[model samples]
Target chain A: MNGSAYGKAEGMKATLIHGTHDIRVSSDVPDPVIRDDTDAIVRVLRSCICGSDLWPYNSADDNPQGDRIGHEFLGVIEEVGSGVRNRTAGQLVAPFVWADNTCDFCAQGLQTSCRHGGGWGSDGTDGGQGEAVRVPFADGTLVPMPGEPDDALLASMLTLSDVFSTGHHAAVSARVRRGDTVAVVGDGAVGLCAVLAAKRLGAERIILLGRHTDRTDLGREFGATDVVAERGDEAVEKVRELTGGDGVDAALECVGYVEAIRTAIEVTKDGRLVGRVGVSQYSDIPLGVGEFMRNVGVHGGVAPARAYIEELLPDVLEGRIQPGRVFDRTIGLDEVPDGYRAMNDREALKVLIKP
Target chain B: MNGSAYGKAEGMKATLIHGTHDIRVSSDVPDPVIRDDTDAIVRVLRSCICGSDLWPYNSADDNPQGDRIGHEFLGVIEEVGSGVRNRTAGQLVAPFVWADNTCDFCAQGLQTSCRHGGGWGSDGTDGGQGEAVRVPFADGTLVPMPGEPDDALLASMLTLSDVFSTGHHAAVSARVRRGDTVAVVGDGAVGLCAVLAAKRLGAERIILLGRHTDRTDLGREFGATDVVAERGDEAVEKVRELTGGDGVDAALECVGYVEAIRTAIEVTKDGRLVGRVGVSQYSDIPLGVGEFMRNVGVHGGVAPARAYIEELLPDVLEGRIQPGRVFDRTIGLDEVPDGYRAMNDREALKVLIKP
Candidate 1:
């Protein structure tokens, strides 16, 4: 594949955020060039719009003209820089949506805190919702599969680039253990993935707090043992009753709302733990000392996506996990705004874009 | 000391709580009898009124009339039941103020949560502020020193019966380490003792948040390296500045008020820990999830007083720790109501009551 591409000059197609709900599809941009010896150019096969991307898309403060978007992607290597030895052209690999796993924070499994880690389009890097993109730390961050995966598997594998890893981190931070009862406090893709992670981590029971029938069905398929349609106190009471009045052993809070976090605490028994994966924009929500003294532990910020991809890829390949089921809809690169609308309107659990 | 014969059958004087703020000093009650084989009756030599006693005294609900009121004491054993093997007649001992120390919870070093560890007065147990009292689980709960302690040492040792151990548990729960900076969130005896505990645990810097000059002086003497006269945000800012823009490594929350707990959280750095030792009468406070996700851990509840008595007795006997410095005044059993008034009015840090 490398020999055939020597004389070809290819331009990339990308989605740019011109303004809130005003994404523009452009194809006149130069293909990403590998600036460093450890970089590789990947021909994006599949990419997906993330929930966080919607923040800038709908925000008045975001660049009104346009900027690059998208983050999650799985692709085939198109070109490799001189120092890129582990991966060859035409091989399939997935890069962690946000980070290069070589910095100090990444080494500590805190890739979300990586010094160079930032959202793709927001920082001038071509967003993953494009035809081609450059991936740094290719040797460390990109996980190559055993062989080319089928289209279905490829779409699911794309989730490992972000959402799946995020959900897994939530479970890990909550210290979910075998035989522990867990409550997932969201029903988005990440929340659905959390159910998979909790099950893989051997949680005895998983109670998903969601209202969508499709999402809840996927949650059950991903090992959610129960679902709580009611929220707040009702949700907490139902969970406690399911666990013999002891509440859950762990709760994964994927929603950033104060009420959701509170529900997580109220739904867990004393000495249990709650892992919060939401990026909180509000700081005034106080953590009551009296409640925490009952032995509740709260941990988690951004997911260390780059750190978990390689560890989770093998399970994905072996069919031991199927996180991609969260992508309830898929569309072409030009349909980005509709994907956002679907998610915003609660019409889709996740939207995958095939470039 | 076991060779001494019983002098006479006589009635013992006790300060009883007839109702809210209605204390009666009487010498009509019979001497405490050892009902269990593992019990021992002790003649109180030194006892003190605690801040917690004020709760029942000031309760809007009718305070149980004719009940004993205090729970901190150091005394000599006057009699032992048949199955008592560790303590005998005439042995100087400090019994745990709350627990038997042998139940499942007690065995797990959570004696305060033991199945039978209810409040002494409410459970029909004689209050420590009396001429004599029966101690359950005498063999496991009371620690006998090598020899008789001097007056000052005995009073300080009496603190180990409750407050001192509680402060130590707060420090332990907060994971105070050598060279770490710590903050004590209250100015009461427990907070003062937390300052001492922080010092003992090798905290390099101790910040006491209080305004009382006497308590501040004693806090400094007890190893508080710094004192913050400011309250709320100002206090948090001062602590952060003292810590070079980072917050303290640990915070000991000794006040149950909403503001005090918030101050403790605000003054602790990301990834640091906070331990709450204050007793909360209500459960409506919100646990701010955003602040907690900065990697703060909160843990602590009722202290297992019995768990620390043995470990602290040696230091007390050697005159190395002076927890008794918290006692600002001493009064006779007849002056019980006055002692309560002094503490309730913040006129005394702690009041030692003599039988």
Candidate 2:
């Protein structure tokens, strides 16, 4: 040990939940102590609520006690463990919320379901919405920006923590090839981001199924060629007609509802692909095995945030991507419950919480 | 113009269905008149019943009033139109019952869903299980065998028309790469044939989910490395345990039911593929969007029989493949109803109706 580097106890502040929806601001929570040499502490700059957060918020039985919520964030490194050679204190970073990139599945791009790495906000770990968080496998999880980001870009950068990566994963898993027509089955932040991802990936045409004018405008700005205000079967027919009798080549399922999954399947052509990124609350979906046999490919899982953070960081820093725009509202940490309510009521696409 | 060969009024006998389940043995059906000049008329030497025939047989309201059922056969060519130079009269041939194989989709290996090809049995054309059949696109759809076949080999050769091709298609669509662990989710003839196909495709481990001892034994004989008797979640767990908790790399879904589709998803690991060959009666399935995001690929449709018939005929002729052994029972044409009943009751693996 280097004697010159005197020991100083690390400290962090986090939000804790006592029971279902009972979130409390706990400032004196001990800062995360580095367990592995490959860990680092990050001072969260901006964090936001995710759609998955609503699951526990809405379910009284599943989430017995108020649990830590939120999983997306942009942060700055406050301290580093001995083995973490890639990041140092004061460096701005964004880390994938789950997954270590070295796993076999992660290497194959199935990082969301990584076999060895995963962390939920309820696990007593620092949630992304908190002021400070601990990240393990720093080298494989965190990506540093070239420089400090301005306030305007921070929220968008924060979106990369999960939603952007998830949207990208959905598009990739759906096999959105060049010149392909794509349909996005949700209008949430992730769905909006998926529209952008699809455009960035060069889909020849993009169809967004959303009724909200603001979201629809964002979708169009992101390169959506058409918007279907109707939903379910009617939406499917509209997409089919837009493609001149053939269905879209790919579909991004961002809402984990049965109807949305069906819509994704219905709007896609034979031999096409559907990337589903929603956190499914229901276990059973009546997927037509025969219809899928007509050459449809379904793929998507948890977003491997770590695998994409690095690749997307530079783009965000260079202003090539604008994912943060999905955050229609930003508020102080205390207003989180209201943000949650607004999102639940579909009044906001995403809510950014600044602690 | 070839005037001398053009004006002959050649008549052929064919089995026609005038209404739902009303199959008639028509002797004076207009001989398949050559329309494109690339067609050939064959005197049927052998034809067998197919599992798909039961769809119309069992349906109470949806069955077409008049539609041919059989789509598997071997025959001797009696006449060839002007442009049909590939097969001469009296030549023994096996023809794909689908359509002309020159379509773009067919070239891309999706012949079953070909843009220009009509599906076998679904098309109201002459059926294969008859005294004589007219085959269009003779050069592309027909495969000439080595020499005259023995009786046993003829029955086996008849399988090349549909079952074997379908099995091969399922295996291929599942992306059964070399050294992969594979699971067959059905015990039908197609499933048994899939065992052979998986073996031929170099699967390192092949597990068959079945209950019948006879089918299990046949599966083992056809290259099933393991047999799982349990169904549903329990069976999925068994397969995962056998593959060291990772599940199989590829799965063949030959049973078209909700349970079978669920079983296929449950038994595959991340980054694996599932090929579904079963015609699903139910069009909607509850898909676990989150689970699917982990990277399971689903791809399969109707089997492109015409595409594989030619490629498989050589192997069949040389005795390198034994797909025909899947037929556990054989009956005369008049016994077709009993065959249907036995199959519907799950009492027979496959029933080959000889006409």
Best by lDDT: 1
The reply for model 1, stretches above 4 Å from the true place, is A1-46, A51-63, A66-162, A177-179, A199-230, A279-297, A306-320, B1-45, B54-68, B74-108, B132-147, B220-223, B280-293, B307-325, B344-347
TM-scores for all predictions: 0.78, 0.87
Candidate 2, A1-355: lDDT as tens digits: 2312423355445655554565566556665656567777788888888888876667645433345556787788887889877789888887765556778877976666677666646344567767777777777677786665788788778877789888998898788988889999888888999998998888999999988888889889878889999998889888988988778888999888888887888788876678888877556554565465566767776777777777777777788888888888888777777787888888888888888
Write the residue-wise lDDT of candidate 1 on B281-331 in tens digits.
545433454453455556666677778888877777787889988998999
The TM-score obtained for chain B by all candidates, in the order given, is: 0.93, 0.88
Distance from true location, Cα of A147 in model 1, Å: 6.8
Report residue B270 deviation for candidate 1 (angstroms): 2.5
* DockQ per candidate: 0.23, 0.50
Best by DockQ: 2
In order, the Cα lDDT scores of the candidates are: 0.79, 0.76
RMSD of each: 5.9, 4.1
